[model samples]
Target chain A: MTTPPTTVPSTDIEVRGLTKSFGGFLAVDDLSFRVEPGRITGFLGPNGSGKTTTLRMLLGLIRPTAGQGLIGGRRYAELPAPLTTVGAALEATNFHPGRSGRDHLRVLAGTHGIPDSRVDAMLELVGIPAAARKRAGGYSMGMRQRLGLAAALLGDPRVLILDEPSNGLDPEGIRWLRGLLRHLAGEGRTILVSSHLLGEVEQTVDDVVIIANGHLVRQGTIEQLHGDPATLVRAADPAHLAEALHGQGITAEPATEHGPGALRALTGDMVRIGDVALVAGVAVHELRPLRTDLERLFLELTEAPAHRNRNLTGDATPSTSTEEQA
Target chain B: MTALIRTELRKYATTRLAWGMALAMFLLGAIFSGGFGALYVYGSLTPDGTPVSEVVPPLVLARLVYTAGIQVAYLLALIIGVLSIGQEFRHKTISGTFLATPRRGRVVAAKVVALVVVGALNGVVHLLGCLLGGGVLLALSDLPVFPEPAELGRTLLLVLLVLALWALIGFGVGVLIPNQVAALSIAVAAAWIVEPLLGFGLTFLDGAEWLAKYFPSQATTATLDLFTGVDPEFARTLGGAEDPLAWWTAALVLLGYAAVMTVVGWLLTRSRDIA
Candidate 1:
């Protein structure tokens, strides 16, 4: 839970009218957002919401059909040494089968005139020194991901873009990745990491940009997005609890019935539970507040009926809505 | 450009496939040359008369250079060419490669240069193996232990040209296919199977005689005339009855294939998205 240092650039990445089409279907369309530096921006979306495509376009792997994405006021292809400018791990397993993990990094390091020592240093940094000599084909998915990260860090880049870097990582590996990213950001590098696993990116990201059906649904600080105080409360005496809550002008709905008189209520405040118990003159043994996790927020943001219908009909065209609210 | 070339060389040097192909080419050449030398030594003796020249340079060198230098070098070139570009896409390593450089054109150019250098190296190795095996055969036989400078030079030059062409052709195929398995299969089939079959079939076709000269295998066979000394009658027979092109013309045609394929591959590589 190390906070990113203040030296990290607060510069923002801006995308406008970015559109990409594979034949008749648009993979990314009119999508625009800003990823502020000095903060871990969580790029979250469903499987095909253009997260990977957008990242590719941003990295200049594919040309945008009608728009532009900029890093530090220039396109990725325009950068003199992209490795030194923007470190990226778009795919965790992108490696040549015959090359050793150490050689893989060495080749990349050679591209920017970086020393071979950097390869060894990065390998050790990522905790894969033992596996460095083994061919990349033999590496587990987790080891490949680490090797990819080592490559991304070869030039000591200013910006980092990683997509689902924790796919096959163990709990310890995931935590290690989180710490490493935070440390890199602490050194003034702008970081943008994407993951479908909401819980994985929850504690790591400072801000979040959510998309559904190739449309930007929400973009803001985690505090602004999840700071709202809402909790679920359950109590005994189902009928009495509802009636008592209603008389108090507090909204309460039946969540579920467990036993003869035990009941759960979806309410905003847990304090209301104590008041309800005191007013109803009931002895309360089980009262708990349910906190909102990233999983629930993700579902609420992306599970809209409109999104489902668009995805079903194959019309999830990226709408030209490049709105950004810092 | 230097950095790109260095990167390509580094890749080639470290890959296991390149080493395997090189070793295979060396061994295949040695075995073929040794077997041919043994036969010549046993067969070239005078029955009831004195031996004129016990050493048979043509048979020994031809077998060594053609089998190892031409055939094995071609296979090795194809392997290197395909692996150079095809492996990047196959393993999804292109993502990281482009990420570092982002200049697709330069990367491709480097690959072409690397493949050509590798082809040259293959030629050098083939020459060394030929000389070593030929020298040993000459020593064992009761023939004059002397080498014809002109003939040996011509043979070496032809071997070099064939190896270079092999690499160029391989580069074109690898770029067009951009998959190691597919490129290798196409190269192998074109060399070992398709081109020979096409040549055999074309010889019987009404008007395909002249056209057959342009097929890679036929062109290579015609190009081999530089070493064996062009027999005008044989050239005409292979060129066909209608309007057969000259040996040089056939070589140019094969060169044209290499040029066109390389350009197309370069363009595709420059524009294609790397996954």
Candidate 2:
């Protein structure tokens, strides 16, 4: 037995051609991404898009069918002290039901000869000291999330991998998590959090990796991926303005909800759109650019495949994901 | 290895299921001992027309060992063994356990050690109950109230071995059937009903005694009989008993079951992705 190492080197994660196949179906197919040090990367996809499977492979909970997921140039299984190097919460409800939160953490600590003080520190760190004595079975989903976070952070790990961490958190808990993730990233730690909800990870993540149907559809900084932002332009005589735009060989759609006065150009080249309006002898009332939120960008990039998948499944909503499968 | 074992021991000690089953085992052992002692005090000792007063120390201790140690203690040990691994799958804690120790083989080894110790402790408690209950009844009936030191030590040692093996079997059963409810049902029914019914049914065939002796329950009896040094004359006098295998042969068969179940269970756990 050895004392748990207090210092963990901050390290980046690189997944190279990672693939996972369950029987005949490919859950994560040729997926590749890099989580740089000092950045929070959001692993985003629709349900059943293989987010959890990729995370599990990265954490070494499951063997990859092909390729490798590396943490600081080493496979997770090769790390001498994996708990300190990579802390993972693959599922929020994975703890033993009958054990207290404190005892649960203590068991893991005992394995590595980690001191009792580390357990108490984690309890305090996750704000579960009041409920630490209670059995995990009786905890609410919100509390379970906290306990899961505490367990993941118990070793003061350099890399944190969390799957749908905000699923059970209330608004306040979500805010706290956002601040904490930012703070951890500020400390040069690499964080990979996967979620189906784009809104949840939009503010917290520095980079976003969006996938659909077991394949990467897009990956870049939030700004880099929000290319050719759209703008709303309200014009007098929208029919005549539409003709003027048609004459210029640029397509424009009527702002459906903006009533008779508005048209929207798909491109963010406002100067050209203004020049077009001036030439058409149309007066512009409201010319404002709309900053695309992650949800819209996500839908634009991945919606085609997500829609095709939903059609095959005969369901309107997204299917359940890697957590549901083996 | 010590840390893993310590964690396993703490896990067993902390669960209500483990403590509850242990307490039940002790109470059942004591009650069964008292009942058996009363039967010895009043009922016929040997079917060969021997008087109750003529009952020897070996026979009395043997009956006590068979009932309290083999019958009662073995069942309790099996339940404890099954829970050792069953509860982890039941409560979905295997993920955390495997995460802490990525090598699954280490976890299985630790479970074996933990359950064996727990089995031994339960065996000691069960033996104590038998002594206290049987000793009092013999003293009340004014028969010889004490056994020779050799007889006592041999009986205690046999009880411990029987329990430890039963526990190993139980752990094997749990690993083979990880679902808690399904595993418990199978273990109980297989032990209390299925094996005995098969053993009894096999007796109808000509030259079937040989087949009947290999049944799990009969194998258990052979183990207890061989370990406690049951004499051949006494064994023949009882019409209820069957011809058992040699003690060492019976031991080998029982251990073979444990080893096979363990290997199969480990292989199943190794191949599947835990979700």
Candidate 3:
């Protein structure tokens, strides 16, 4: 066996037209996305939205009904040293209850001729060295999560795919996990972590791929999802303000999310908007740049009517859904 | 392939189930051997100070004592085989197992090799238990402890083969039935109750007596009968086959069961999704 690389080689993840259907129920529907190297990409979806299924397919645990999930342009099963190339913690419960955590890691490690020292190091890395000798069946949810993470990192893999990794982590544990993920991503490793809550990973992830009902809702950098720079300007006379902004080649529309009579100008410059209002003889009450609340945007995108009805249509594509202004 | 086998062996070694099963097999084998040894020692003694060597030969009695526990050992071996794969599915560890190996065929093959080794180990432990208990009783009676060294060695080797084959059968059954509890219950129930009942039932059916010899339990007896030189009258009282098959034929039949189960199990597992 080749030696485990001290530094992870950068590998991007790509899913192209991947679909999985269990009997009549479609789990993941024509899903496609790309996760670049050296970035923490949050695979966000609601419960039962096929995040786990997609990850399993990626790891070759579950065969896709159509299409493929690739790491560094090769299928997971085809990798020469799969464990070294892609380390995955699909769930914390994928462990034998009777086996100790260290033995559990050793069993997996032995498959690739990985040394015992690496297993010990991984247990330490995941902060479970104290409990490594304990049976996994007795492990708490948080401990199991740590054990799962340890098993995933045992191969010192270049790519990490975790499914709902934060499910049982305490606040402090979550912080620790964030730090670990950041450090791994810093090494130019590709990290695809799935979670039902966008807020949980909003700060940690550089990019987000949001899906609902097995269809891609959106896939982009967090900044891109936030959209272009815009300002929320609430004017005393909204119609007059809109006409004034229209004359000046700036579009102003009612900002319903902010409340009635509030206008949203398609520009980020508050000073320029103030100048425009003054020139148009429009009195502005509230003028500030719109900071997108990703939490609310996540809820809106996943719960939208278009997405809810997406499975009903035959011609629906896997392309990103249009972001509706709230 | 070697790595996969090593991983499978480690998986077995790490679990308490393997050790526990081995202990259970040894204890059961010892108890059965002691019970058989006591019966033979008392039954052979006569007031005239002349042993009934013609009624039941000392060599045959010694062979019976040595192999007395194998009846239970083979069943235990089967259970071990079942649990090796069954436990993986029961605990959902199969997901991690597949993730580590990816090629399901290799994983199954490795498991097959590991379980066969485990079965042989179980056979060795069971043999030790039998030797410790039966050898003492035979020696106490002043009878030949190992009447025929060459024959006993061959019999012991076949006993190991029988056990390993039983375990492979269990592994196949475990694969066929992924639910640990269900597979264990069904397999044990069939082996312990259904098989014997069917064997006895076949005796009353005219011309069906020949088919009874193919039963796993009878096959086991027929296989051992080749070297044991068991008294036909005594064997008949214990529900032995009316017409025993050749030892090699019986061994082949047992091997056939193991092969069928493993192949079918592999086929089912090849494309089945882990989740």
Output DockQ, candidate 3. Answer: 0.82
Model 1 lDDT, residue B14, Cα: 73
TM-score of chain A of each: 0.81, 0.81, 0.81
Number of the predicted model whose TM-score against the real structure is largest: 3
lDDT of each: 0.72, 0.76, 0.85
Q: Write the per-residue lDDT of candidate 3 for residues B1-275, one digit (tens) a residue.
A: 99899889889989898788878877777788777777756654433443433346666666777888876898898899899989999999999999888889999999999988989998998888888788777787777888778877878888999999999999999999999999999999888899999988887999887888898888987787743455566567544666798889999999988999999989989998988
lDDT of 3 by residue, A198-247 (tens): 98999899999999989999999998978887788888899998998888
* DockQ comparisons of all candidates to the true complex: 0.61, 0.47, 0.82
Candidate 1 C-alpha lDDT tens digits along A242-309: 68877887666654433345444555567777887788986666666545555766766776665542
DockQ of 1: 0.61
Best by lDDT: 3
Going through the candidates in order, the fraction of native interface contacts each one reproduces equals 0.74, 0.43, 0.93
Two-way lDDT contest, 1 vs 2, winner: 2
- Cα lDDT, model 3, residue A252: 82
